[model samples]
Target: MAEVLFYHLDRQPLDRVLPGLLEKCLERGWRSVVQLGSEERLEAIDAHLWTWREEGFLPHGTSKDGHAAMQPVWLTAGDDNPNEATVRFVADGAGLPDPAGYQRVVMLFDGNDNDAVDRARAAWKEVKAAGHDTTYWQQSDQGRWERKG
Candidate 1:
């Protein structure tokens, strides 16, 4: 089963919550997959995630296969766009399908990316149609993680 946790805060910095959350995952030696957009955001999360991982968070886990230290995916809008179109873009940058295999899958989205917003909607649809259990995000006043059925 996948559990979704939403933190409602207006001024809480991403720098603060991410490290602790990643560390929390490390405290128990659980395998985690961190997915986000852009190198800047990935680096920000990596500041702490990498440290925690190196400190024996998960010795054999924490794979940074795609990007520097996280799952780096780009968002695209239309056909023949620069790279991919995100979840709705019908490109390679697709969101998670089954988050059941891992302990936690944390996705950090800008919540303002046009393509990303649409992809999030599509992801919600995919989840419902496929009956996958994962923490999905729906943009609003506060970031809400809607679990798939």
Candidate 2:
């Protein structure tokens, strides 16, 4: 079964939190796919990953970049997993893909947005019913993640 993690982003925005998570996946030698809710966000994140840090960047590409199999991190607004990623991160209220082939699925939602929180709640139930091991992590006042449930 895949492990599903819900990250409640209240203290920081997605752009600030995502790069670190992607770095963790790289350290574990796991390829990842970041699914966004719109093409605009996909473009924005694709650009951000390249310059998120001053010293180095996460190796990533979008459909326009081609060579999907060569990217360590694939960014897309669709459900396609061209990189055959073991980890999938869904942000901006993107639709969840099937968790069957993935080792882990991370859902990042804005805690301050009621609509986003509601969607995450619904997603939690869905993933639980689908039999995935699920966990919830909320950001503390210090911006550290605390496992809530």
Number of the predicted model whose lDDT against the real structure is largest: 2
**For residues 1-149, what per-residue lDDT tens digits would candidate 2 score against the true structure?**
99999999998999999999999999999999999999999999989999999999889999999999999999999999999999999999897778888999999999899999999999999999999999999888887899998
RMSD of each: 9.3, 0.8
lDDT at 1, model 2 = 96
Candidate 2 Cα lDDT to native: 0.94
Per residue, candidate 1 scores C-alpha lDDT tens digits across 88-135 of 112123354354443333444334456655665665566556555444
Question: Each prediction's Cα lDDT score?
Answer: 0.40, 0.94
Q: What lDDT is reached at residue 87 by model 2?
A: 98
TM-score of 2: 0.97
Candidate 1 wrongly placed segments (more than 4 Å) = 1-14, 38-41, 48-94, 97-100, 134-149
